[model samples]
Structure formats: structure tokens, C-alpha cells
Target: MQEFTLEELKKYNGKNGNPAYIAVNGKVYDVTNNSHWKNGEHHGYEAGNDLTEPLYNKSPHGDKVLSKIKQVGVIKKD
Candidate 1:
């Protein structure tokens, strides 16, 4: 898998023609094609962020939705 630093990960915010991606459990997932992640934002949750805490603690749907998405890479320890 590819390795990305926090700064590099910010580039894939699903905006301005960039692909949408979010990190969770140290893994990066491509949400660019996900209906819920359209335009890189979903219910105030934006892509290009480390969503580990929010997804695990706040989301009703949880990180289970990530199973359907592609695992693109891993975030380098900051």
C-alpha cells in the first residue's frame, strides 16, 4: 500500500476534481464514488480527514460502510 503523511492526505479532499479519501484505523479509503461522499462531504463530515474518532464514536452507521469502499493506502504516523 502507498504511504501518506497527514499533509499529503489533505490533498485528496474530494474537491476541485480531487479524489475523496478519509483515514480510519490508520488506513485510507477511497470514497470518491460513494453516493454518501458526493462532493467530498457527507452530513458535515468532510473527506481528506482522519475520521477514525468521529466514525467510531459519532456515526450511527459507523465505519461498517467502509467495507464497500476501496482500501487505497495507509496514513503515515504523524
Candidate 2:
């Protein structure tokens, strides 16, 4: 898998035709096809961000939802 820094991943925020991506548990997922993630924002949770906490605490669903998406990269530390 590929590795992406937080800053590098920020470029894919789904705005202006860019793809949307989010990091969770150090993994990066491509959510561009999910309508819920249109424009990189979903239910107040924006893409190009580390959503480990929000997905765990705020989401009505569980991490099982993550299994459906494609993992494109990893969120690496600086």
C-alpha cells in the first residue's frame, strides 16, 4: 500500500473535482463514490481528515462500514 502524510492527503478533499479521501486507524480510504461524501463533506465530517475518532464515537454505524470501501493508502506520521 502507499503512504500519505496528513498534508499530502489534504489535497484530495473532493473539492473542485478532486477525489475525496479520509484516514482511519492509519489507513486511507477512497470515498469518492459514496454519495454521502459528496464534495468531501459528510454529516459535518469532512474528507481529507483523520476520522478515527468520529467514526468510532459519532457514527451511528460501526467500523464495518469501512470494509466496503477501497483502501488506497496509509496515513503516516511526519
Candidate 3:
């Protein structure tokens, strides 16, 4: 699998017709075109925030999100 930096992932932004992905637990998730779930806005708290803090913790449908992007060939093995 190709490795991507956090800054590289942020470049996607789910805008400009590009897909987004988040690497967690050795898995990649495609969150493209999702208004609610985004790279920095996942779980209502921005990325790099303190996990212990009382923030919006929601189950991110990353798998499902990846499926959508894969269907469109946005996320592919490099």
C-alpha cells in the first residue's frame, strides 16, 4: 500500500472533484463529498484535537464512504 502524509491527505479536501481518505487502524476510508464527515471535521471535532476531550464522537462510516469513492475509481491501489 502507498503511504500518504497527513498533509497529503488534506490536499484532497473532498472538493475540486477529488476524493478524501483517512488512515486509521491500518485501514483507509474515502470520505468524498460528505458534508458531515470530513478530514478535519470528523466526529464534530477537528483532526489533531485532544481525543480525551468531550467532543462530538460519532462512528464514521469510512468503509461505506470508501465504497462510494471506489465505485467511482477515486480510491485505487497504487
Model 1 misplaced regions, further than 4 Å: none
TM-score of 1: 0.94
Candidate 2 off by > 4 Å: none
lDDT of 1 by residue, 1-78 (tens): 999887898999999999999999999999999988889998898999899999989999887788899999998985
> Residue 52 CA error for candidate 3 (Å)?
11
Ranking, lDDT, top scorer first: 1, 2, 3
RMSD of 3: 7.0
TM-score versus the correct structure, for each prediction = 0.94, 0.93, 0.40
Could you tell me the TM-score of candidate 3?
Answer: 0.40
Backbone Cα, N, C clashes tallied per candidate:
0, 0, 0
By TM-score, who's the top model here? 1
Model 2 lDDT, full chain set: 0.91
**What digit string (tens of lDDT, one per residue) describes model 2 on residues 1-78?**
989999988998989999999999999999999977878999998888899999999899969999999999998776
Model 3: how far residue 58 lies from native, Å: 5.1
Ranking by TM-score: 1, 2, 3
Q: What are the clashing pairs of model 3?
A: none
